[model samples]
Target: MLAIRKATVADCELIHTLAWQTFPETYKDILSPEQSEYMMEWMYSLENLRKQMEEEGHIYFIAYHNDEACGYVSIQQQGENLFHLQKIYVLPSFRGVHCGSFLFHEAVRYIKEIHPTPCVMELNVNRNNKALKFYEHMGMRIVREGDFPIGNGYYMNDYIMELEID
Candidate 1:
């Protein structure tokens, strides 16, 4: 069985652990080792996670299968009716099991509950990521491309994808 729950600030450590475990594998072939390390510390460090949760309005959800943590997703309102899907990742071992879809639907559900009308849900995905197709299949369309600098001379070369909610 799969379970999804809203993550509290106390879950930062768990989120950090899962992030470090899953992030490298997801980006290993796409990013250099040094870049990956920099990203991990910059994005998933406990302090940053705490800031994201406490001050940045990021809402996180943790997914578990048989009581074992397997994945997580985070979202935050970006505008009047626009929300950003900041992160969504599942363990490679759990891929192909529909956990991604489950988390996605949960995100949409949350958005609908809050906005209750037409809106946009968007995310930034690496242009070369295999998951690009997956997001498209879930009704997202690329709106633009970007090369966002995240410090230390690295840029996130990505497609800005959006899904309409109505």
Candidate 2:
């Protein structure tokens, strides 16, 4: 069985740990080692995670399977009717299971719970990421693509995918 809990500021470290374990592996084939390390520090640093939850309004959820932490997801409202699926990652060992889907649906549930109306959920995925199919399977469609600069001369060449919730 899969369960999800709303994460608190106290869980920042756990999220950081999960990011370290999963993010690199997720992008290993698409990102260089230097770029991956840069992104890890830039996005998953403990301070950054806390800032995201506290100041940035990113609500995070931790997913568990059989009492073991397996994945996490986060959502941030960007507009009155627009939300961003900022992060969704599942550990490699948990891939075959429904961890990713659970997290994805939980993110949408959170958005709908708070907004309770029509909205759009958007997520930026690397153009080469295998998860592109997963997002598409979840009913997201690529609306655009671009090379977003992420500092240190690194660029995230990605496709912006969006799902309309009604």
Candidate 3:
């Protein structure tokens, strides 16, 4: 069985460890080693994670399979009715077991409870990511494309996808 629980600031280390392990696996094919290393420090550093959870109001959830942590997801409110799905990842070994879907639905459920009606959830996925079809399968459509610079000359070439919450 798959279960997901809200993550607290205390779980930062665990999340960081998972990010370090799974990120490379996910981006190894699309990103060079230097780029991946830079991104890991830029996004998953303990200080940044703390800032995201503490100051930015980003909510995170960890997914577990049979009591073992396997994935995580995070979301942050972007506006009155807009929530950004900032992150969603499942360990490679857990990929086929619907862990990502579980985390995605959890984020949606949380958004519905916190946000008002007529809300929408958005996320940016790399243009070359294999998860593009998976996001589509989950009812998201690419609304636009962007090349966001994240320092050190690195840019996130992504498709900005959104799903309306009914």
Candidate 4:
């Protein structure tokens, strides 16, 4: 059976591996080959992930199966009650296994446990992505449109979607 939990320091290495695999594959068509590689390096580098873990209001997690990390998500509770889901990724081989959906569902549950007031979860998703449809299917709605400036010619055109948890 699969399990979802808050990621510990020991899970960092595995989370790095998952990010390396999932990010590039998912952005293959949406980004130039070079741009994708650059963004992956910047985002998934161990140093950045480590620093993010120490930041205030940050909650990151990993999904596992028999102790192997299959996916991860990083979120930030930025201002008032909005949780910014910075990244959510599952291994390529794990797609259609419901790991992504499982991660998303667990995220909602986790937020409910922490926030006393209504919590809003937001994520940036590519406009043409099939994952966008999946998000809608998951009951998230489009709150706005925006661009994620990842630098090095890697700005992403995405929908800023949100889900409100009571």
How many steric clashes does model 1 contain?
A: 0
lDDT of 1 at 91: 87
lDDT of 1 by residue, 1-166 (tens): 8899999999999999999888999999999999999999998999999999999999999999889899999999989989999999998888878889989999999999889999999999999899999999999999999999999999999999999999
Candidate 4, residue 36: CA error in Å? 0.8
In candidate 2, stretches whose alpha carbon ends up further than 4 angstroms from where it belongs are none
The lDDT of each candidate is 0.94, 0.94, 0.94, 0.83
Candidate 4 clashing pairs, residues 3+ apart or interchain: none
* Superposed Cα RMSD, model 4: 1.5
The digit string of per-residue lDDT tens for model 3 on 1-166 reads 9998999989999999999889999999999999999999987999989999999999999999999999999999989888999999999888899999999999999998887587989999999999999999999999999999999999999999999997
Q: How many residue pairs clash in each candidate at the backbone level?
A: 0, 0, 0, 0
Model 4, span 1-166: residue lDDT tens: 6898887666667778888889888988887889887877777788777777775556788888677788988888887888988888889888878888888888888888888679789988989787898889889999899887878766889899999889
Report how far off residue 47 is in candidate 3 (Å).
Answer: 0.9
Q: Please identify which of the two predictions, 2 or 4, would achieve the higher TM-score against the true structure.
A: 2
Q: lDDT, candidate 2, residue 23?
A: 98
Off by over 4 Å in 4: none
**What's the C-alpha lDDT at position 9 in model 2?**
97
How does each model score on TM-score?
A: 0.98, 0.98, 0.98, 0.92
Model 3 bad stretches (over 4 Å): none
